[model samples]
Target: MIPVGAYARVSEDKALRANAADWREIGEQVAEQFKDMDALAAELGVTITRRYNDNNRPAGDPHIVRNDFEALLVDLENGTVRGILFYHSDRLVRQEYDAARINRLFQLNPTYVGRAVAGGTDLSTQEGRSMLTIQATMGGMEVYSTRRRVARKNKGLAERGHIHGGPRPFGWAEDRRTLHDTEAEELRKAVLAIPGGLTVGEIRKQWIDLGYEPTRNKKKPGTQTLQHSTVETRLINPRICGYRTYLPQAERRDAKRPWMPDFVVRKDGKPVMGNWEAIVSPEEWQACVATIEERKRARVEGRAAHTTSAKYLLSGIARCGKCSFPLMSNQYSKGTASHERYGYRYACLTTLGGCGGVTRVGPPMEHMVEEAFLLEVRRSLGTVAGQVEINETKHDVRLARIDQEIAEVSERRRAKRISMSTALDLIEELEGERDELNRQRRQLVAAKVRRQNISPSLPEEWKGYSVSQRKIRLRESIRAVMVHPAGRGRRFDPSLIEVVWIEGGK
Candidate 1:
C-alpha cells in the first residue's frame, strides 16, 4: 500500500470554545475526521503512516502560525510520506499563497499524491490544483465577510451602550450592569487616590491586604493575585465612569497603544454613557486620567522618582536652602562621651549634588511640619466647604452650556450645514472649555472630601494616618521645607527651618 499523511484542522469558532473541560468535544470531532480520512485512504489503497492535526488553530488568518501544518509541509518536502490526505480542500489550504506552495511541492515531487475525502480531488493533478486554489480563495472571502458582519454588529452595540461579551469587569457583577458593592467602592477609592499622588502599586497592595481579588482567571482557576497592571487598567477604564469605549481590533491588539479619550465612543462630542451605574464621577475620572498622563510624561522625560511609598515624612519634599536640591533621608551618627548615638536625619548629601549645607533631625522637623499642617487644615476646612459648593454649582451651569454647543456643532456637521473644518474648529474650542470646567469641578470635589475627612479632632485623627497618607496631606498644605545651614552648637533652633506653605496659608 502507498504511504500517505492525514491532516485535520479545527474550525476557528470551535477553537474559541476550547478549554480543559470542552476539549473532549473537540477531540471527538477531530477523531471522526481522522476516521473518515482513514476510510478514504483504505479505499484508495494507501496506508496512513502519520497524522497531523492543528487543533484549535485558525487557518484563514495568515498571521497565526500553524506549527503542525508547517511540519506536514516539511515531511512532504523530505519524502517522509509519498502523499497527503485531508477531510476537505479548504481545511488543507485556506489561502491562495498556501495552495501555491503546495502546488510547487507537488511539481517538485511528481510521485507525490494529495487527496481530500470531501472533494475527492487528486491535488497532484493540474485540474485538482486549480480546484484547490478556487476553494482557498472562496475560504478567504468568507473569512473577510464574517469579520465585516461582526464588526458592524459590535459597532451598533457600542453606540447603543450594550455590554459586549468579555470576562466580567472588576467593579461590575457578572451581568456587567449591576455594581458589585465592595469592588465598586474599592474602585472609587482608587480613582480618588490616584489624583492625590497614590501609585498603582500602593493601591494594589491595599487591595491585597483587604482580601480583594480580581476576576478569576478562566485558564488558571486557582490564581487570584491582583497585579499592578490590572489595577492600573481598571482605574483607567472609562466604564467605571459610565462611558462605553470601543477601539478597532488592530488598536485593541496593539500593546503599545496609550489610553486616551479617543477610545471612548462619542456622539456629537459627548461621551456615550453606558447603561450601568457610574462608580466614580466624570470629573474624578478625568482627574485620574490627567494624573496618569502626567506620570507617563514624567517617565518618558526621565524625571519621575521611584514610586515606592515614602518612609520619611519629608524626605523628597524638603530642599536645601543653599542649593535648592531635594534632601535625602539618612542616618547620621553623633559622637558622645562613651558611645555613638545614631538618629534619622534629612541631609543635603554632596554625593547627590547637594551643597551639604543642611541637616536636621527627622523627629523635630516632622513634628513642626505636622503642627503647621494641622493648623492649616483646620483653618481651610471651615472656608472650603461653602466655597466648593458654590464653585461646583457654577461649573455645572457652564459645563451644560458647553455640552449643548458641542452637540449643536456636531448636528450641523452631520446635516451638511457646516464644513468639516468649521465643525472641528468649533468642537475643539468647546472641548477645551469643557475640560477646564471638569478640572475645576474635580478640584472642588477633592477639596470637599478633604474637608469632610478633617474634624475638630484633626490632631487625634491625624495620628491614625499612615506615613503615605500624611505625606499627601502635607503636600496639599505645604509646598516645601527649606532648611538653612545651622551654626555649630545651635540648640535645635526652629529659626533655621522655614516652612513654605502652599498658597492661602498663614
Candidate 2:
C-alpha cells in the first residue's frame, strides 16, 4: 500500500460541532494496515510515502478546503505515495462530489484506493469492488440523511409565518447572545451603512469596529460581515426571507410538487413565507442594497474603500479651522474609578511628528473648539432665516416617498396576485429602501442643524462633564480613537484620538 491522504468534513458553523470518535478509532486501525504496507514497499526497494490525516471543515469555512488534500490526492494518483489512508469511506468524503477530486483518484490510481476496515477490498477483484461500492454508498447516504433531517425542520418552521433566524452571521453573531437592544440596533445600522458589494474582507473590518473579530485559524480570516458573497448566497436561500429551498433528487420524476416533506417549492407559482421571525427588518436590508450599489461604483472606479477625514461630535470635524488636519484625540484616566475618558484637541495640520504653529493642548483647549465650532454656528444661524422651511420641505418629500412605495406594495398584497413569498420580498426591498432613505434624511437633518445657529457651546452643565460623560462622548463621536501610550501603558498622556462622526455635519 502507498501513502494516502484522509479527511473528514466538518462545517465550522452551527452545522456541526463535533465528529464521532468511532470514525477516528477506525482511522487509527487503518493506519496499522498502511504501516504493514510500508514494510512491503521497503522490500520492493521503494519508500512508503507519508500519510495525511485531516479534519474536514465546510468548504465555506476557510480552513476546510485545504490545498494539501488535493495535493495528496495528486501524489497518490502519480504514485508519489502508495495510496490514501483513512478510517472509513465517509471519513474521506461524505459524498462523491464530482470536481476532479477523489473521482480522479479512482481512475488514475486504480490500485490506490485505501480505507480503514473494508474487509480486504481490491478493485481488481470482483469481491473487493462490491465491498468498496457498498461502503461508498453507505457513506454518501449518511450525509444525505443528515441534510434531509435538517431540511425537514426548516420547512416545518416556514409554514408558521413566524420570522426564523439561525445562529446570526458574523457581525450579528452576538445579537442573541448579548441581547442588547443597542447592539441589535448597531447591527442594523452597520448593515444599513455598509457600502454593499464589499468583499468578505471589507465589511468585516467595519464589523470589527463594533467589536467582533473573525475566528480565523492559520491566518485565514473567516467571514463575519454581510459581503457580496454572503448576499449572493442569501438571495437564493429561502430560509433568510422565510422559505425552505431545496433541490430534491426525487425531482428526476414528474414535478410532484416537491413532495419530499422536507423540501419546499413555489406553490402554484406563488412564493410561500415561513413562520419565522425576521431578524433583519426589510428597511435595513435595503440600506445594505444601496451600500452594495455604492460599493459597485467604488470598485468600477478602481479605488479601495476611500479613507476620509475623521469626525467627532463637533470638534474633530472642525479642524484647527486654521490647520485643516483632523483634530487630535486626548485621553485621561480616573484616579478613583480607574476608568479612562477621552477628548479631542486639534493641532496644526502642517505638523507631523512635531507641531507646526501648534503644540500639545489639554482638555482645557476642548472649550475653545466647542465655542469656535459649535456655538459660533448657533450664533451665525440665529441671524439667518429659512431653516424651518427647508427642514419641513425635506421631511415632507422623504415621508411622501416612503408612504407611496409602502402603499403600492400593500395594494399588490390585497389583490392576492403575487405569492406570499414574492409579496414578502417586495416588502423587504421596500422596507430596506425606506430605511436607507430615512438614515440619509437623518444625516441631512443633522447637517442642517450644524449649518444653523445651533448651540455648539458645551452647556454649563456639560462644562462639568466627568470622565464617564467624556467616555460616552468619545464613543459617540469616534469609532476608534487611538491613544498611543508613548509614555508606556502606565499613563496615557497626549493621546492621539481618531474620531469618526456618527451623525450630523461631522
lDDT of each: 0.78, 0.43
Residue-by-residue lDDT tens digits, candidate 1, 326-416:
9998865556421243368788989988889887778788888888788776676656543424244567767677778888899999999
Q: Model 1 clash tally?
A: 0
Q: Candidate 1, clashing residue pairs?
A: none
Taking the candidates one at a time, how many backbone clashes does each contain?
Answer: 0, 39
* Candidate 2 TM-score to native: 0.38
Q: What's the C-alpha lDDT at position 360 in model 1?
A: 75
TM-score of each: 0.81, 0.38
